[model samples]
Target: MDNATAKNIREGLKADCTKCFGLCCTALNIVASSDFPINKPAGIPCVNLQNDYGCQIHSHLRNKGFKGCTVFDCLGAGQVVSQVTFKGQSWRENPKIREKMFRVFPIMEQIYEMIAYTAEALSYDIPYALSDKLSAQLKEMQSLTKLDAEQLLSLDLVMYRLPLNKLLTETSKYIRESLIAKLPGTKNSKNYNHERADWIGKKLRGKDLRAINFRGAYLIAADMRNTDLRSVDFIGADLRDANLMGANLSTSMFLTQMQINSAKGDINTILPTHIERPSHWIN
Candidate 1:
């Protein structure tokens, strides 16, 4: 696929809550914690949901101890389930379909998440061979999203995701190796290992952290200004209050909306095109 097509697909996968029926608030269970004010079971409507399918405490979610809600992104799965899967019929109106809708929402969510990741991989300036493979995989994944509800439930997404994940991994490897080769010297390259390290309050300015495994690392209050973070896997990374000023993360992988929401950044923090800077970030 061309860059424009890839961009369009990525944009379409973004969450549009206005077109959804508050599926995240209902389909996913929330445990009482620092992030959530109360415990809510799966399939039960959150107490904050309004009659019109809007969050009554959306603007004040974090203030009211529901910071988890502020970071949640359904990746357009909510709308797909609300409109395409059920033909715009809500659980409230069709109580009979509520159970099925809840069951299908999570499956669609996994599909859309893969779609987002594959589309992002296709946008990278990789070799023609890799790009062609990614394009084919992207087309296949997008086709699955159009499947009927029954087909979606029966579909083996794990089978589909395995190969796509392989492609993404290879793409990340190529980008990281390329970036590392361009670094100034061996000392700089040798000093670039921060994978799963305790980096709290550590100054990591201008570091070449491409393809580093930061999954579940504690990076709270670290200085990460002007860091080259391309292809880094940030799944489950705790970035709360980490300084990301002027950091280039446009090519980062597995960096979810929730991770970005938890971090602190300034206007200069360069992020992936699909992600928006949190409003709480410094201007």
Candidate 2:
């Protein structure tokens, strides 16, 4: 990356990080590994993390079993939720506020994901005339980052789209129509609302469903026996007690740290999200 590009990325990271407190590492658990020494529970602190909220093993996280840490990018998501929303109080400092903290974290994560796409849009040199509107939207997003847990969850963030919806639509069309026009082997995939399905007892044994979108799918008590689900989208899926024996989700999309905490899976269950895989089960 060029210096300008690198600088921009750094600024983005700084802006976002200023609002976060490495909550992904602190609020979540990881199995014992060379990277993370202790297997902690959700709402519990890592053994190596300092009381001041800095990682005791920050320098050597990679040398430990935390090789996954290097690749995991909250994309400035963590910092934003941590500092901006919570007002500099970390979950570690106030254990009594765990539930509220956890609840808000995922919402902020979603907003950050949207911001990431917006940042990418900006980089393509969005029209100079529309630049002022984009700047205003960016400011609004930044302000939203400062909301508390309940406030964030209650706000209809979609409203921000009202001003730039048409512009963004045209911009997206330009990208898809111009840069991505007629690209070989680049077929756009379709999304399905396979919700409320009676997957109660059906055996989905060893299915190759990589990148399949399963948002809001009702998978209650489903027998997902060893499915290959890398990078699959599960944004709002209801997976209460879903059996995921030997299933691979190494590259799943929208599998936030909060959602994983809410779901039940064993070691044999492959997870694509960045949180540490729990250690209780064996493949």
Q: Which candidate is the best by lDDT?
A: 1
Q: State the lDDT of candidate 1 residue by residue for 16-108, as single tens digits.
A: 898888899899999999889899999999999998999998888889999888777878888988998889999999899888898899999
lDDT, candidate 2, residue 165? Answer: 51
TM-score of every model? 0.88, 0.47
- Lowest lDDT 10-mer window, candidate 2? 1-10
Alpha carbon lDDT of residue 248, candidate 2? 85
In candidate 2, what are the lDDT values of residues 1-283, reduced to their tens digit? 2324422632364224335655666566577754355677765556665655566766666566554454345656676676666767777577766667876776676566555434434544446655555555655666777777789889776676555554544444443334333443354543322434445555677876554556567776667768876645565566655677788876554455434543456777877434455432243
Candidate 1 stretches with Cα past 4 Å from truth are 187-206, 210-226, 235-241
Which structure among the candidates has the greatest TM-score?
1
**What lDDT is reached at residue 258 by model 2?**
36
Model 1 C-alpha RMSD to native = 2.6
